[model samples]
Target: MINTGKQAQLAQLKDSNAQLLKRLTARESRLNRIGMGIDAASQEAFEAFADGINGIAQGVEKTLRNERDAEAEKLTNEATAARRSSTHTSSDTAIADIMQDVKGCIEEQYLAAEKNLQVLASILGFFVDVDAVLAGCISVKDTQIFIRRSILAELSAFDCIFAAYNKIPNGSQIAVQTAHSRNGVPRDYVEDHYTQRTTKGGLLISEACIIHDEAHGMDHAPGIYTDEQISKWKTIVDAVHARGGLFFNQIIALGRVADPNFLDAQLKGPSNDVYRDREVKEMSVDDIHRFVQHFKQAAVNAMHGASFDGVEIHGANGYLIDQFIQKQTNKRTDEYSAETLKLPKEILDAVVQAIGASKTGVRMSPFSAWQGMRGDYDPVDQFEPWVRHIVSTYKDLAYVHFVDPLAGSSQEDFRKSDYLKKIVRDAGITVVSNSDLTLEMANERASKYGEAVAFGKLFISNPDLPARARNGWPLNEDYDRTSFYGGTEKGYTDYPFYK
Candidate 1:
């Protein structure tokens, strides 16, 4: 006569209604208290509220258990009555069918309640003090405590370490960087580099990505201008994709970093400053516009025709982009002066405009004095405005890669500025930390600071670095320093994978 399943559902509905009333009342109270300040609510009251919610859950479980018992008794009585009558088989079948239906009803009701609870959670999350709401409904704090305890109990507990490349795409937590493989490449050469790296034990994987070494738009270094170069890049991209790896092209304008004597054209820099014994002539606004277009064109070629997944604007290592970013190199009185980050910003914006910001990345070395790009002012103070602007403008970029000053200089004086780490982290962008990072240091920084560590020398030598780190295999220590800058296959792909 009385259906216990429907009764249980009624009881649950009533409980949900009461809980909603209590939650709303508590929210009002909490809101009023929060108006006074966060500390207005006593810890005891918070704990008591949490206990009350727990009690409500326990009461629900008890009520459900009692209803289930009643349903079992009712079914047994019906079967007994059927047995006493002449139609036992018919009655038993009817009771079994009803029981199945009741079970289905209960399950559906439970799912409905779960959905309602989720809706409540999402609503509560809108408030700043949802932690208080959560603490009431919140096993989250408890769960975190449990995790900490469990980690302490375990001998091998570790924090998450992300691979810099995967962090950008939000893929698997492993990455490899294209650092000093070769300065330039021909069509076949590019393909060979990708093939060697993306092979079974090589750096590139479906989970990993590759950043092609800087293409300075100079002689032999590779440029995205021509159809042949575009075709070659497409070949490399397809190869990497076939092997399950993404490829990114890094493009640069060398500025004073390029040798005047070596270049077919005149050397250009931000100011008419002599660098490396070469008299660097000042770049006109037209040159600046042309260079920005160069970056945009490179991005277009890379993403549009070349089939590359993304492009990282080379704004670091004292190149043209870096040259404009610092006061030391940029001496112009125009809008594109050292006081303005117009050049680097424009280059990044142009590239982002060419290939959407999601696929555009930029690398900067605010603290690096390499290639004579250091400014006269304190790096931290001098670069704050530019860093702030970058963070504000291109917040959603694929990543903002940084090369630490520590990579270049070991002087304690150079390490004093904390601005390098703070800049991108404050911007809340995906970061690729570069410059002489070892496997352990990379893991530590990636875990602690939420960064993706980019390895230069190590990735060059250890093709199976992720595997080596994962499996606790010893890394190859010796890499030919002589073959680091420019080389053939000997140092590039000849390094043996861990057996």
Candidate 2:
């Protein structure tokens, strides 16, 4: 009897356990289904909203263009009548009034467009996929057309069209010549594209002043340290700063230090093949010190003269410093070996020692593959050492901006967000995050991180992004794809603004 009771109890317990497991599995499946449904609904709603706004924008754009044409025709007719009548005395007053009216109309139109843009931007701000709408392979001109067609006129006046066009290259043509070869491009081309297009007013708060890589200018021969090159950079920085705009100063190339010899060899290599011709050679501590000294002096000079508001160390994008930090790249057997890699600390120390810690910022693409970068070892191992270095040595630096490796490319190599957040929090340093973030996403991340978030594309379209973001306004879509690199007025200055 006792054996039978024990067996029966055991059987009952097993059955109960099985039933519980089944119930739990069913609950989880239901939850997952609910989540998927929510996501699908959100996507549908966003698409609908975008389509509606775009339709309104197109109509408003058409109306404005027609109105402008009509006004121009009326003015032309009045001018012809004045010429035919030979009534100089009365005609002058009438003509002056007409001119004033035309000016008023232009101003009104500009205001209307600007207002509509802001409102549309605000609506789009609620959606998290603004990056798809704003960045990536799409052309700015196409984006502008999309915005003009989608958003309503009431919201059109709030767009960033005025801001976007102001940054386009104008007047200057891209001339290919030998004189500009010092900067890689022909002298005439440089003069045509850079000199003729840029203006003092335009330089102030222009979108290009923020998003374009500072290193693009460093492509000039003999590197950025040359007197002439440094002088030109100073002029550009000063001009932008004078206009109350922020200029990001590109510091030393981080990965180059891992093999300074390789850099030298590449620079000295055949003129036609520079970026990929030579293999990386080993670098010594002395080499790093020398490079740091040169960069420090340049930064100090720029800062002293109020050339830029701040300087960002190009520590990210698999550059010299990152190369050393990454295990696969830094195969040095000496004290700089992976086990005892102290190069990051040394580099940080040199920079912090030279530039005041408060004025310095470091950019890190912890998992980014830009510039042919591949973090060969486990990302955690590659990143932990650098994070440890940052906590210990450069704690007082302004902020650490991390370029999320998962962004802008199709790669699933790294997804350690939780780990990164924990480390950053423990380190207690201000962290600014970037990578595939839309305005809405950035704001959300900022809310969670309690620090600023950087937006490359939004900054490209909206010169006054900070202000627009704060006011819940719409942003103008970038319209000109071709002009983004080198062009003038058609895509640059033609975007109208709100009054």
TM-score of each: 0.60, 0.51
Model 2 per-residue lDDT tens digits across residues 74-114: 66777788689964445445445544654465445445433
In candidate 2, position 446 carries an lDDT of 50
lDDT of each residue in 1-499, candidate 1, tens digit only: 4556656655664565466457545644533332211122333333444444445455445545654675677668777887799455554565566557656555554454444444433322211223333334533221110010011001111221122221111111112223322223243543544554553212231111112222232323555666655776677778866764546677767887775432555777888988878787888888778777877887887788877766777777787878888887888888988887888878888888878775776777877767776745677765667667776887556666777767557565345434555666655555566666667776776555555555556655776665677788998879777765444555655678897
For candidate 2, the lDDT comes to 0.45
**What stretches of model 1 exceed 4 Å from their correct place?**
1-189, 199-219, 407-418
Question: What TM-score quantifies how close candidate 2 is to the native fold?
Answer: 0.51
In model 2, the runs with Cα more than 4 Å from the true position are: 1-180, 183-248, 254-277, 284-286, 338-341, 408-415, 477-499
